[model samples]
Target: MTDTLLNHHDEGPTTAPPLLLGPSLGTSTALWDKVAPELSVTHRVIRWDLPGHGGSAADLIGPGATVADLARLVLALADSLGIDRFAYAGVSLGGAVGLQLAVHHPERLESLAVICSSAHFNGSKPWEERAETVRREGLAALADTANARWFTPGFTVPGLVEDHRTADPEAYAACCDALAAFDIRERLSSIGAPTLLIAGREDPATPPAHLREIADAVPGASLTEIAGASHLAPAERPEAVLAALRGHFDGYALRGMEVRRQVLGDEHVDRAQARQTPFTARFQDFISRYAWGEIWTDPTLARRERSVITLTALVAHGHYDELAMHVRAARRVGLTPEEIGAVLLQTAVYCGVPAANSAFAVAQRVLAEEDKTEG
Candidate 1:
């Protein structure tokens, strides 16, 4: 648990919330290739390989292994990266591990997504048989069969097939062994994190019924079933998968940029966006997500009301640059110059005449510039 994990593939702003992407049994983190790029836009996407898959070494699995053991490895991976809390989405065995984390490490996960996974996995006998077959005949024994079960007919993935073909038999078998004793149906209701279950209609490996079981058990959980998709919905129907993911991580960014653009005007927002570089990216994301998304998007008060308060505070605090920006934004969101002048007049009484005087000067300059540009 203390040892640091290696070769974790990460994307997006470090300031964004951490999002863990897990793969099915025998598959590497490559399973999420189709879904990660779009999702990274709203999150710090962290994808890792299972023990013995891809760049990951099989050091965690052994006799009597369970999903709990795999879950601990996931936690250790997060800990090594200094991620205390994260949203998780996984496929098959990875989804089971997500469920395990939601059950045991509830506080550590912000949200849970179980894709093409099950609670009992049909009592593990199927898993044990698969494990024994791989142990005796090696990876090929399961690869040929698992490939078909993983994807619908007429859809073949060479890289995914190669992943199963090259995986260590023992490690792959150990993963199956972990599934042998896994069952958490009773613990479903105890999960507090928001949960989403995605099922593939054609996936005989773990169909809609399995995801339904999870949805019905977990409080406030929802289910989505994709037609014509087998176990690999993210790969088969990438757009649909991305849509579901965007919906799941919707709050991470909180739709703040839209409001910011609406309030500040497109030209102002375009300039702010153009100014972003690697050094300022995280700060920009922070302001956009929290300041714009959380605060600006709040419906408790209208944008105009918030604008008046913001303009007044900026003027009172002597933040002339910000006050100027809000003054323009206030005009954009429909506050007339007279209304803005009244707010500044009120600010003069409480925050002092000098502050209001300076604010008026800044506002006058911005308004004159706007008129000149229009003309």
Candidate 2:
């Protein structure tokens, strides 16, 4: 259905990889507040509200809406932002929407994480009854019981409860309708994206068993059960949730490290790892994940081609130290001494004689060291 898009909050660098965060039924983008910022450091995190739940208009969805409807709105949001593919993570109803996208719109997802959600939602009976009650009496009565249903004992998030209490009854009931009709059990095996299932160990609503069922069905899917957490794992146990999301979404980290070693050499990587402190660890991971895993691993350009471009950039920027290291890398990647000199010559033409002159000296020193080693 053609409608105004859902209300959303966009964070992090726009140029970073996109990650869409979806909220549970009664909650808004606020559900992700605790975890989104950390994820935003590596990704463009876009958190969206359910229809009528926050800033979104009630008319964005109507009664008898399906999870498919919510999924469409999410896709519409991504399209508007010019994101063709993204990693997705969601909580409860939001997780169900992620499942829908994984099953039907697999091409749009780089990865999927379903947190405290299930495929069938324990059938349609309970949701239908809940929908009927909300339609007749509104959300106040249900909101009063949300804390027990959502969190472990002696814990609560007041803002989320307030969101539940203030949600439009009609729209909330429509989300229930969507839940009532959603049953992707049969289609679980068809989901092709890399999938992760996070279960709140103490969650009464959708227990660990529910997430396990999904993990068993989805190919290559992994599951993580967070201790002391209930339905809203990201809120109750933000660190645990963040760790799982990073492990799943950054599956590239291992590959990136391998590529880094290949391009930078084992001695360099070993020294860097030995020198890594807490402060520099994240920066190193960014280099491996973004530079080697993504840009270098991409097959569109050969290693030799990348070396040429990298050398040119290093020369133009006059980063002599970096240029020296890459000169060694260029040799490792199969660039000959003559080819390296040719690249430095081109840099002299465009990058200026002085910068290229410095680059040539660095390259010459590196090449002389290599010759001595070979001798």
Q: Model 2 segments beyond 4 Å from truth?
A: 1-3, 251-255, 345-360
Q: In order, what lDDT does every prediction score? A: 0.86, 0.93
- Model 2 Cα lDDT, one tens digit per residue, 1-375: 224988899999998889999998888898988899999988899999999898888888888999999999999999999999999999999999999999999999999999999998999999999999999999999999999999999999999999999999999999999999999999999999999999999999999999999999999999999999999999999999999998888756788999888988999899999999999998988888789978999999999999999999999887999999899999989999999999999999999999988998899999999999999
TM-score of 2: 0.92
Question: Cα-based RMSD of the predictions, in order?
Answer: 7.0, 2.3
Per residue, candidate 1 scores C-alpha lDDT tens digits across 265-372 of 888889988999999987888788788987888799999999999998898789999988998899888998899999999999999999999999999998889889
Candidate 1 worst ten-residue window by lDDT: 1-10
Q: Total clashes, candidate 2? A: 0
All candidates' TM-scores?
0.76, 0.92
Best by lDDT: 2
